[model samples]
Target: MAQEPLLRCSGMDKSFAGVPALRDVHMSVAAGEVRALIGQNGAGKSTLIKVLTGVYRRDAGQVEFAGNPVDFTSTQDAQRNGLATIYQEVNLVPYRSVAENICIGRARRRFGLIDWKAVNAEARERLAALDVHVDVTRPLVEYPIATQQMTAIARALSFDAKLVIMDEPTSSLAEREVATLLDVIRRLRDEGVAIVFVSHRLDELYAVCDTITVLRDGRTVADSPISELSRYDLVSTMLGRELTESERRGQHVGATATAAAPTVLEARDLRRAPVLNGSSVTLRRGEVVGLAGLLGSGRSETARALFGADPVTDGEIHRDGEPVRFASPQEAIRARIGFNSEDRKGEGIIPDLSVRENITLALLPRLLRRGIVDRGRQQEIVDRFIRRLDIKLAGPDQKISELSGGNQQKVLLARWLCTDPEVLILDEPTRGIDVGAKQEIQNLVRELADDGLSVLLISSELEELITDCDRVVVLRDGATVAELEGEDISEKSMLHAMAEGTAATGSRQPSGSREEDEVHD
Candidate 1:
């Protein structure tokens, strides 16, 4: 008879505070197979991992491991039962020796005292099996991040783990290190160990995963062998739509005829150390410019540099055709440049504060008189913005945390709009919100731009950029590859420019362009 599969989970369900995170998700893995778990942010990938690892309790479902049903109450129990995990951040003690990190929990004992020599020898042998040769006696911190990750894998195997769950293990590793880690994973798989790989990098997933599973909004949408899916299909599956001609039409939302408009802000060789390499962008009076590129392509860096959040050490910046230097964000704001950060939960909102307080944060100095807050004026301005933005909330005094993701974002936008800045930079503004909220925000952006607001929109969604921006500046490896304008705004062309890392300045107007006069898609 065939041997039973190593791990299987059927009808798994989990929720937090009545919000369903995972719904009837079914998954399985053989002894030596590599399974990829992928989804957008807040799509229940993390919750699924936690349920499997006992970091969370399942509200309903069944999880079977090694031919028997299991419900682990703690992570330690799960680890002891042969399921091991390695997180993006290595969890080993920094001061401990490499050998200790590997065999610290499973050390050989002698004479009622832990034996160090045997542990080091065992660690050395374990690493040697994976073709890693490192001094096991040295402190873990002294070694590079790649070596530390290898040590973590060794530790997991030391438990004789049947399944290894690697959660973004190479998120912070250098390219060379990533290659080495992939080799190690292959080696482990050859030894009959099942692996669960979770990451946002599609290239890496295609490289290592044998089977791919995609999750969308807490449901398992697609599960198939890697060979069956192309990169475009994978992206479409994850995003929940194929780009048809219907979706392409009426996508452009920003100003189309801005040829006569003058530049409001200009970046001449904007640079912030190694992240940005003499990148230049121009913001006109009534147009939206999209910053397009893959992850780590310096999209956010460009925004930060423009807003003076990051120091512009080697660039010339001008506002309203006049050259100026802004050493801090305050100076940028004073010069009428506003920025809405990508990390809304971390940098955009203070959860403990109320809606009114968060909305009026940037307008404080203007609303202050004799070192006192002008409550009536503050109320008038806050009420006006709240109504204008249609921010859904219990009351102006409601805790900002009580509001949904979209409302919190609206509050941030209000904070900037109240300032009446000449230019606004929005980075991933609709990332984790619902579909309704995303559309609302998109409409609002178009309305604002029509009223002569200069916007710099940075989003991972190509359609969003193509739909909203009059032009897109493609960046690759910290440098500008191409600038698409007029009829040149299309995903095919942008991907070409990004993949080639070269400028495609052809006048090929896409079929969907509102105007047939120009070419560029």
Candidate 2:
């Protein structure tokens, strides 16, 4: 007979403020199974995970764990009952020692005293099982991100957890680190631990998961063995439509730049310590230039340096043929340069503020009169951008936090557009949003560029860069090694440039003008 599933949730329903997050969702993971839970942002993946881990109570459902009906009151309660979660960000105290973080709740005690030696030994044993060797006595912050992630995994297993849920565990990890984490997960599955892995990376799902469950809107849409699902079908199921080839490849707004185009912004030999070595980029008027690189290749660092959010150790920035230095973001804004950061939640929005406030944030200085905000002018600007961007919000007075991820991103974009920037730098502008929203943002970006606004685009997704950018610059080891423009830009050429710098024969050499090179498609 088949073994009973390790975890089973049937007819699970959850809502917040009368808005249903999950509707009759069902998921099951058998012992020794590796299951993938995937969906776009605001798709109830988080809600279901919260309910399972006791972060929230389900409005209606039947949940059984280990052949027993369970409703955990808290994460601690769930951990004690053999369920553990490792969030995308490592949650342990940074200043705490690795050993202490691992054996935090269940520290070894002897004679009413904490047993330090036993604690360290146990932590080492747990880490060694995952092939991670580290100085357990050292603070967690001293270690790399991969080590810290392993520490989180060790802490989860230290509770003798039967079911482990990893939420975007590899989002912050490099390629090799991802492989190592996947190996550790496989080892855990072999040891009969059921795993529920949550990630947006489709490659990771195919790599580690045996079964898959797809959630769309607020309901479970697909549940099947991972091997049985094609990548195209899986994406179609999650998106509720068979994406056209044009949509999948990204549809460009037919606009191209010529050699006669004026140079708007130029960064030469930018250096900012360890992350950025010697990066250089040139943006032309009415052109979208893509910055492509692997993780840790200094894509975001370059953006920060350009925006004056971070100072560069060396380099010069020329705006419209005039050399300029911005001491801070305010100065950059004054220079008519707008930056949309990749970290949307942390750096983009003030969650407590209203949509109108967020949309007009960067323009507040211009709207100030007698040291007071000009509410009339603010509303005018906010209303105009809201209508232009088509941001879906109940009202301008609604809290920015209440909006979905896509709408919130649109608000951020609006914040920059209101400034009437000469050049806009977008770092992963469409990340973490739904497919439709992503397409909307991409189209908006193209429209903005076509309007003669110079744009510097940075994205990890190559297809996005290919379709949206007029030219692509490949960054490796903190330097721009190759440039692909016009018809030369392709997945193969970009990948070659990224892997082996300057290997792509289509790579364009530095020149005073691109007159000879005209965009074909």
Q: Quick one: best TM-score, which candidate?
A: 1
- The candidate that achieves the highest lDDT relative to the unseen native structure: 2
Deviation in Å, model 1, residue 478 alpha carbon: 8.0
RMSD values for the candidates in order, in angstroms, are 5.8, 7.6
> Candidate 2 overall Cα lDDT vs. reference?
0.85
lDDT tens digits, residue span 1-521, model 1:
04476888889899888989999998888788888988876778888888999999999999999999999888789989999989879999999999989987678999978898899899999999878899999999999888888899989988989999998887667667778888888878888999999876555677788987888889898888877877656666766655554434134544556757989988877765446765777889888889987666678988888787887668788899999877789999998888999999999999999999999998899999999999999999899999999999999999999999999999999999999987999999998899999999998988888889899999988889878888888775456667887666776667655544554558232222222111232
Clashes of 1: 6
Worst ten-residue run, lDDT, model 1?
510-519
Task: Go through the candidates in order and give each one's C-alpha lDDT.
Answer: 0.82, 0.85
* Location of the lowest summed lDDT over 10 successive residues in candidate 2: 512-521
TM-score of each: 0.80, 0.68
| Residue range 1-521, candidate 2, lDDT tens digits | 06789899999999889999999999999999999998765788989999999999999999999999999999999999999999988999999999999999789999999999999999999999999988899999999999999999999999999999999898777668988999999999999999999976555777799999999888999999998886646655655554344332333554453346989889887876555656888999888999987655678989888888989888889888999878899989999999999999999999999999899888988999999999998998999999999999999999999999999999999999999998999999999899999999998999998898889999977788988988888776566767788667776666555544443664685432222222111
